[model samples]
Target: MRSLFGDLRGKIVGKNIKIVFPEGIDERVVRAAARLKFEGLVEPIILGEPAAVRNLLSSFGFADPGITIINPEDYPEYEEMKQKFVELRKGKATLEDADRLLHDVNYFGVMLVQLGLADGMVSGAIHSTAETVRPALQIIKTKPGISRTSGVFLMSRENTHERYIFADCAINIDPSAKELAEIAVNTAETARIFEFDPKVAMLSFSTMGSASAPQVEKVQEATKLAKEMAPDLALDGEMQFDAAFDEITAKIKAPFSPVSGQANIFIFPDLQSGNIGYKIAQRLGMFDAIGPVLQGLNKPVNDLSRGCSADDVYKLAIITAAQAVQE
Candidate 1:
């Protein structure tokens, strides 16, 4: 883990990256911010009252955090940010609506990224995933040609060379064929960041035509579309987990695919499957699940589990900072 983050810091340090933490009142978020500052990982700008943040850090015995605290009620550029939010919404929001929404730290923090005052943002310690994601979807928006944002978890084994990516695990509940294709392409780009030569498998219960069902057809169509989108990418399937993982089974069931028997990236057919699959690998496989890293947004904004420890906040923030550098 030290080596993993050391490599990340080597790439991102001195780039002067700034990461915004919107859940300023959450102790885990604040503790992580303090550690990030102490380590000089990135400049952390926490959203809260200056005094409140100072006092909170003091209570944690971190009296000299040297981090920036921006109070929404007192930010000098509130008017500019509020108006910018309205314009970004393109009539979905009036100035009055923007005024109210920007007061919420998630909205304010996302605006800092939107305005390029911050490189990226991380939240969701105490907020729902939607609470943090809605602002990025509306404000930062997805990258051009990406219809929606997705998430990927980096599954790395300790003391081994094994690392894999699991996608669509935290966003896009029931993606269509087109949406699934987009997730595959986006996940591929993410894999490159971690230096993985992605061999994506579009996972499903059926392996090729071994079974026929509407859900199976969806994975098949998604696989076809993903291939069209990235013709050079090594991916295939509508395959079962066994066919994708076990060499013997892959040869028997899906011998023709370049991805069969050796897939490092797994794109789940839906959020339910994606969510469940990653958790199983994390808890049972004992892999270090380093993220539910948000991707496909124009700027990076990651979500932390509400039950996250300070270490979780610390690591995800590093990952978010790295994402900003990649952008």
Candidate 2:
């Protein structure tokens, strides 16, 4: 995990990237922002009442943290931001609506990113996934040629430092074949960002027709669509976990598969399996799961688990800045 973040830090340290934290009053967020500022990693823009945020920092022994804090209620550009929000929302939001919505920190922080005052945004330590994502979807939206955003975890082992990508874990309940294919392609791009060769495995309960079911068929179709979408990508599908990861099982079950036995990116069929799979890897396999990193956004905006610690915030902020640099 140290090596992984070291690589990301190398990319972002001198970039002068600014990342917004909406839940600036949260201890974890404040601590992480202070660390980022101290390390010269990224400029941390925290959203809260100025006096309140400074008081919170002083309580933590950082009397002069030097981090930027903006209160939406009294911002000098509040009226201009409202106009921009009205423009971004088209006819869906009037100035009256923007006046109400932009006061919410999540929406306000997202506006900061949308208006290019900040490079990215990270929240959800205190907000739900919906609260963090809904504004992004409505404002930042996805990149061109992508329909919806997905989340992935960069799972790494401790001693060996083996890393892998697990996808669709934090969003999308029951994706269609098209959406699954999109996840596979997007996850492959994310793997490359992390310097992986990106041999992708579309996971399923069946391997080379060993079983038959609707779920298995979905994997099969998704694999085909993914291949068509990225013919250059090293991807194969409808394979069981063992077949994808173990050379011996690959030889027996999928001898001709391009990604068999060497796949580093695993695209799960749905949210249930993706969520459960990463957790099992984290607990029993002892892997360091470093996300549910939101991908396919036009600009980067990541979500933090409510239970996350200060270290988690710091790492995700680095990752978010790295994504901004990549974009």
Candidate 3:
């Protein structure tokens, strides 16, 4: 990820992106924010007490390079933000509800991004996936024409330029065929943002009807729907993993598909499969798995693994900023 992050920093240097880190009090976030500020990657907006944040940076032998730190209780525009939150939630939340929810760092940081004070956000080092994602869905919402959001991992290996995307890994527990189709289209767009010419393979247990089951039928129905949704997309599936990744198996199992043997974006049938697949590749194949990046949001907001390192926070912040520039 070191070289990849360097290239991304260079790519987005002049874009003037600002990324919010809501977990400012976490040790990991403190170190990552220091590196981002010192290196001038992007202006990082931190949420915490100003004095404590500055002290933490000082303890790390660094000075604040003017990173924005906002305390929810002390923000001058608290009333304005409260109204915005209430309006965004329509009748679902009252003014009082908005006021209390805004005090939660994740909600406050997401509001910063939604209001254009920050271009993007990266959180979840010390929060659950739902806590990081709920505000995004409720406030930022999905992009127009997208009914759902999904998570994807950009898988790459050391000393190898082969980069593949694995999707639906961190969201959509048991997506229907319609939701699966949306994940495919949204993930393909994310692949394009990262410079992958997407050839998507929607995976199932059966490859081209070599066997039959409800699970296979779900993938098959989704492949048809996705083709209609993005006709130009190089996508085909209801296939097995081997047919998606191995040229030899693709020839025998799904020979007619233009993307069967050459897929770079893989959409799993469910969260259980997608999550386990990416971990397997990361641990066994030694691939660098760089996401769980949220797709289909109106603005970018990514979640980190709970056990993430300072380096993970640093890289995800850059990736979130890159997504900002792409928009």
The global C-alpha lDDT for each of the candidates, from Candidate 1 onward, is 0.90, 0.92, 0.90
Candidate 1 lDDT, 5-109, residue by residue in tens: 778888787777899999888888998999888887889999987888898899988998789899989898899888888889998999999999998999999
Question: How close to the true structure is residue 313 of candidate 3, measured as C-alpha lDDT?
Answer: 90
Candidate 2, residues 1-327, lDDT tens digits: the string is 878888889999889999999997898999899889989999999998889888888887788968999888789999999999999999999999999899789899999999999999999999999999999999999999999999999999959989999999999999999999999999999887788999999999999778999999999999999999999999998899999999998999999999899899999999999999999999999998887799999999999889899998998999999999999
Q: List the residue pairs that clash in candidate 3.
A: none
Task: Give a tens-digit lDDT track for model 3, residues 242-285.
Answer: 99989998999999988888999999999999999999999989
TM-score for each of the candidates: 0.96, 0.98, 0.97
Model 2's alpha-carbon lDDT is 0.92
> Which of the numbered candidates is closest to the native, going by highest TM-score?
2
Per-residue error for 1 in candidate 2, Å, reads: 1.0
Residue 221 of model 3, lDDT score: 96
- Give residue 195's lDDT in candidate 1 (0 to 100): 70
Worst 10 residues of 2 by lDDT: 56-65
- TM-score, candidate number 1: 0.96
